[model samples]
Target: MPTATIAEDDDGIRLDRWFQRHTKDISFNIVSRWSKSGVVRLDGAKAGPGDRIAAGQTLTWPEELPVPVATRPTEKPREPLSEAQIEYMRAMVLHMDAHAIVINKPPGLATQGGTKQPTSVDAMLDALQFDAPSRPRLVHRLDKDTSGVLLLARNAKAAAFFSKEFAGREARKSYWALTVGVPKIAAGTIDAPIGKQPGTGGEKMQVDTEAGLKAKTRYRVIERAAGRAAWVEFLPLTGRTHQIRVHAAAIGHSLVGDGKYGGKESYLTGGISRKLHLHSRRLVIATPGGGTLDVKAELPPHMAESWQMLGFDLQLGDIEIVEPPPPPLKKRRLSSATSGNRRGERRSRGATDEPKRPPRKK
Candidate 1:
């Protein structure tokens, strides 16, 4: 019998996974039979495959199959990357340190992959590791066509640190966008909630202030182009799917190229290209060592072209950045009569991942 001991990091992980981790040569059927036959024992007692384990537990294997040859590899093979892709990633590095890497990600490149998207920045992330011991891990994500600053933690420890900052909204993110029309107020907060569109197969998102997830953004109009378009800066207080876009539309000034929410009529035809005119302009966040990281990305080519065409200043001036709004309070379900009357009830903002809606079908 070959006995193994579980460690602290493996606590709460499944038992079958333990076998997959330590006994890679053991087949699925063997694990199932051993688990059923009381041959694979835990703490001198029988254990099931789905049992959640804790640290300091001992596992005993039967002598019959007895770990077999144990020749097969445990870790899955990484997808191969071409040299071109590797160089492309290196050129995008905006900031690099021992713990993290920041990239000025370009428009049309997805931060992660999907069923339809085979190749993405995430798929190619292995190439981005310069000399780090491990592949850089994405700490945050930007929408595929919404280009700008994105952060990657160089190691597991750094990943946990950055992940906490975002989860707590201690990180500040600001965006620049060109909207179809000027908002009635030059500077104010748009506190509309967001959710997936009802009939759009969850492909599109809209401002559903009534029953939607809590979402908020603050905006200040930098300049307006004679009732045609307005250059605006936004600080999203909560990460929600299509949050800034939905909030802009809620205020009747959707982003110029956001046809999904605002319709094709929102985009200007002649010279300005109908691309999503939003950019993740800057990020101000804390580093692992009690220091701060302030990073800014320049406007992408299409946005720069639109800026020149609209006579919008390339210099955005000293824009005010504010702290994210306090998290929304949880709402208790109210009676129908009270629900309509209690308009002041608070809503909750729940976003497990950076809230970019899944890509729409082509």
Candidate 2:
């Protein structure tokens, strides 16, 4: 058996990737087989194939004969659908069409499942009973905390076409974010190169000029309140994981309620009305039908409430300023002359009137 201690830079890497780095002789196929047989334990428990291996996790891999392919199941059968699962299936159907389905994903739900839990966007789709033999497929993904427009393809051909469009950078996505402070500039572009942070649970993205992928974002200040938050529109030119969040934070204006990227103040003070103030507001894509497809999602309740509290009119693009209170006045120090002047009258009254004679002896 080979043992490895997870490092800080390895946070968001897959279990297979971790094993590949540590055990030079082990093949990915063998590791996959071991994962299926429950030979690899992450943090003292069985880990799945897609589980992100974070730092501080203890990984143990057994070195043994390859498990028989016949013995190992190809894929686990879907579990019995629960009431909640059924409801999700029903909701998914509402978004279905001939070619694609668009979903209004809520916040706090992961697009894909990890080792510990199975309730994810993909799992739910797997459990769904479609009339045809084909299974639903994800065309794109959203962050766990960001709620809004998500697209899925119904068939393999459709999935392939959409994948091509995404890879070719033909898809256009827009987002609405409430930031902590008003940006000085009204409209500008953030041209930054984004690269994944090594070993930090794989959750962090950093700005790298030399080696990072090129990312471009066009931002316009929709509304700004002096000394408070601002509502902004974002258009990402390239899709890098957490690209928008990291770029915004790099400019010293983190999305409101984004705790991981220095958004604690906005979160705690209820600056923007939600746990995370960013939302996927709109998506425009070149449809398979030779036309454009535009979809928009309404603002979530939390974001709406916060906007109201800050006296913002989304439709009109107006905002009210609630400036922070001014700092207290500092006490002024008195000079030595001023202090002596105040006591000068008393000292003069006690002055002697007689003239003094010169001293003869020293």
lDDT for each residue of candidate 1 in 1-362, tens digit (9 for 90 to 100):
97777765455667876667666567667778888889888899998888777779998888665453332365557678988989999889899997789999998899999898777888989887777655888988888889999999876557778998998989999899999977656665666677788888987887676788988786777778888888888889898877887788776788988887789777897699889999999999999878999999988999999989988766553445344554445653344421321221222222111212234679
Please name the candidate that would achieve the greatest lDDT relative to the true structure: 1
Of candidate 2, the 10-residue stretch with the lowest lDDT total is 342-351
The C-alpha local distance difference test score for the whole of candidate 1 amounts to 0.77
Local error of candidate 2 at residue 325 (angstroms): 42
Listed per model in order, the count of residue pairs whose N, CA or C atoms clash below 3 Å is 0, 10
Report lDDT per candidate: 0.77, 0.69
Which is the leading candidate under TM-score? 1
Stretches off by above 4 angstroms in model 2 are: 1-73, 92-94, 127-130, 268-274, 316-362
**On residues 78-165, what C-alpha lDDT tens digit does candidate 2 reach at each position?**
6767887768655633355666777777777789889854677888885543663456688888988898888877655567668888
